[model samples]
Target chain A: MITFKNVTKEYPPKTHALAGVSFRIEAGEFVSITGQSGSGKSTVAKMIFAEEMPTSGHIHIGDWDISNIRHSDIPVLRRQIGVVFQDFKLLPKKTAFENVAFALEVAGESTKRIREVVPHVLKIVGLGEKGGRYPRQLSGGEQQRVSIARALVHRPKIIVADEPTGNLDAITAREIIELFTRINDFGTTVVLVTHDRDIVNGLHRRVITLRDGKVSSDAEKGKYLLS
Target chain B: MRSFFRIIRFALQSMMRNFWLSFVTVSVFVLTLVTVNAVIVLNVLANASVKSVEGRVQVTVYFTSDASESTVKNVQSYLLGLSQVKDVSYVTADEALAQFKENHQNDPVILASLDEVDGNPLGQALKIRAYNAGDFPFVLQALETPEYKPFIKDKNYNNYESALRVLSDFSEKVRLGFLILALFFGFIATLIVFNTIRVAIYVHRDEIGIMKLVGANDWFVRGPFLFESICYAFIATVVMGVLLSAFLTFANPAIVAFFQGVDVDLVSYYLTNALPMFGAQFGILALLGLGTTTFAMRRYLRV
Candidate 1:
């Protein structure tokens, strides 16, 4: 349920982060946007979340145009799409439970709803037993799971994981990829942006490859096609 | 309403988690109030002492011995007519001599000199009190009229002028010095508060960024820090009030004894204006904290 038509984003002094890109995904489609570093893959995820605006062209998530979204309206858009960063951006002081509950709390959810939903979501990401632990006390995989749990807390229709497995060990990375697959099987649209080839070939879903600020390929049931 | 309570709860939890920083912020606030209250107490003591000295100042006007008692009484009446002259007393030559003897009774040289004068060398004198120490010069000028100056031998205005000048100058200098001290301490307090909030924002920068990513509005992120600052201000004010009350209770007796006869009742002054005074302090400090928090957040709090 997201569309980027003829989208071009440029930085100052002739730096093109993204150029002449067009993509569309129907509701409940899992898509992988893959490329080498600086190939504008992360820029796609940033556009979906309205962190970076398209310099030219149109972007529509369902019927809402976010090509030039207002700063005030960004929060409402963000609530509908959960974002998972590579570094597991959890508040260091907050416990695992508080960290997950924070997303609902920020949305003005009632204490009763927050109490009911936070544990359930954390349990979905397999962090229910370690809810009392802080980020420092948890391992990298556990911390990443906490991030995934936070992203799922609001039941956002689309989950955008930007390099979600970048810091984890190989086995842990595989587990996180499988977790994304599980999330996708539940009919939530998942856009995984990464450079990891094994994860991309393993998924065998819709893959959009970018090279030098342009989309080089888009293939259904695609393999890791980049050198 | 629930979000408002949540913000307050988050502020308290943050305060407890960063207890040392909170303690430092509150202590700086208390120290600033200490400087302010010290200035207030010193101002009160200086004013009372200056007024006591001013009350004792009187100008003595000596009339020639040949001047009649009626003439001296007439001069006294004229001096009393001036608004500058608060009171005037006419001392006959005999009374002046008796006062001189009583004052110099401990000094034989003064007694021998008085006896050698043969018949009350002292003349009738007018002791003039002015409403203000600064008005003595005006009062002395008023006495130089032809009718009054012909009978007058001398006026001891010079002695009171130098003393009043010193007292006035000292009082003004003390007040100026204290004001400068207050300003210096106030600047330090501002910087300390600015840095404290900056560090707090730095520590929570990640959380702040993530909160925005997770759909929090700007006020949602800002409210907790603002409340945290107010919490520090509130606690600091309560601590300062307790300390000041305890100090006045323990030190009031010593202060009274030190001034001896001068009226220095700090307890009554503080007790009377305690609410408005400390309340103003808390307001000022809380505003400072809030202002600094807002500024410090400008760079870090994007949401």
Candidate 2:
């Protein structure tokens, strides 16, 4: 579960990225946060992972207030919440298998366990046979799948993806969305932040749309409402 | 312990992946060490030359022909008792006469003069050497007592003092010059190493961010770069050791022949001090590398 109450972020010289936005999502829910450019959608996703702290107000994830997280605690919080970025963020020198295994290695997992779990997670993201391929050798869709496999390696409770499909074609983007749906079915909360109207309208899932740093609409089965 | 091995493995992998960068870094380290060792060799040779010159400077005292042998022996004993005196050799009147004839054998006029002289006209002499060249004046001054002055014909200390002073000054200047050169090279080496680490961190900037995103701690991110610096130091030291051995082997004989009996055995000096010398070089270079690595990481590596 994630909750934000009266969160506001401001930059220098009168720029507000977020203004008094409040939202709550229960466990095991798939929610799409939709908005056009400059809608603070990515800012919301960064806040969930504690990459950026709220300039004002509080944020809570499962009863733990991360409004002012300590520097040392950020890694622990990040390990609990897997983040997927549009660029995929895979190490260029590492193969798909090594990239997935890196997440477990940082957690100090045993070699035997890594050999076991990395292959299993790569298979889940449809990258089982392409584990030895480097990121440069993989297609854009394949690279995004590798990123998802890395996020799932720790079996995190929540997956926060900020525009993960932004770099892929329409078919690949839809496939990525379906993968997120499959991951959500396994009881992982998915927060997909995007501005793509076709993807959001096709999902017919719970949608929270932001306008001018405020939530403009929240619907149980929302469609894309932006022009 | 497992994580430590893993860090080392990762460092080796990174170094090998960027082979040209690693090569350049180690080459710079070796160049710096070569300059340092050149300074050391110069210092050793200068010290040997100064010592050889000091060994040749002694004071000879000539007594009058009328001085008794017993009085000359007493003077020798007194001079020997001084702590500054390393050795004192006495030449009796007859031995001095014989040595004088042997020296003038090649000159007809000197030989004829020596033959016409009265029986054993040459006086007894004492050749005195001091542990330090500067202490010779004090040793010669000790012989100016009333009992010894009447028989003392001449002292040669004044002839060597000025020359010794010039030699000492020249050696000191040489040492100071080499020291300054060494320091300049050390500064340049530091800058090169600092920039090398910065470039390495810049190249890995994206990888570092990805590591942090995947939940790596700060040490996990920093360990590989620190280990890589130590690797550069170690490889450079080993290469310098090989190069020094080759240089000494090729240059020692020529250096000895050039100095011509000046007791300049560079090979022996380096052989005796190889362990401590090389160990200290490696230790200092590794410390420098580690310090610069830490500084670069703090400035460039956000994690």
The number of clashing residue pairs in each candidate reads 1, 0
DockQ of each: 0.72, 0.67
Q: Cα miss at A50, model 1 (Å)?
A: 1.7
Pairing residues by index, what is the TM-score of model 1? 0.85
Model 2 captures what fraction of native contacts? 0.58
TM-score of chain B of each: 0.84, 0.85
TM-score of chain B of 2: 0.85
Q: By DockQ thresholds, what CAPRI class is model 1?
A: medium
For candidate 2, lDDT tens digit of each residue in A118-153?
999999999889999999999999999999999999
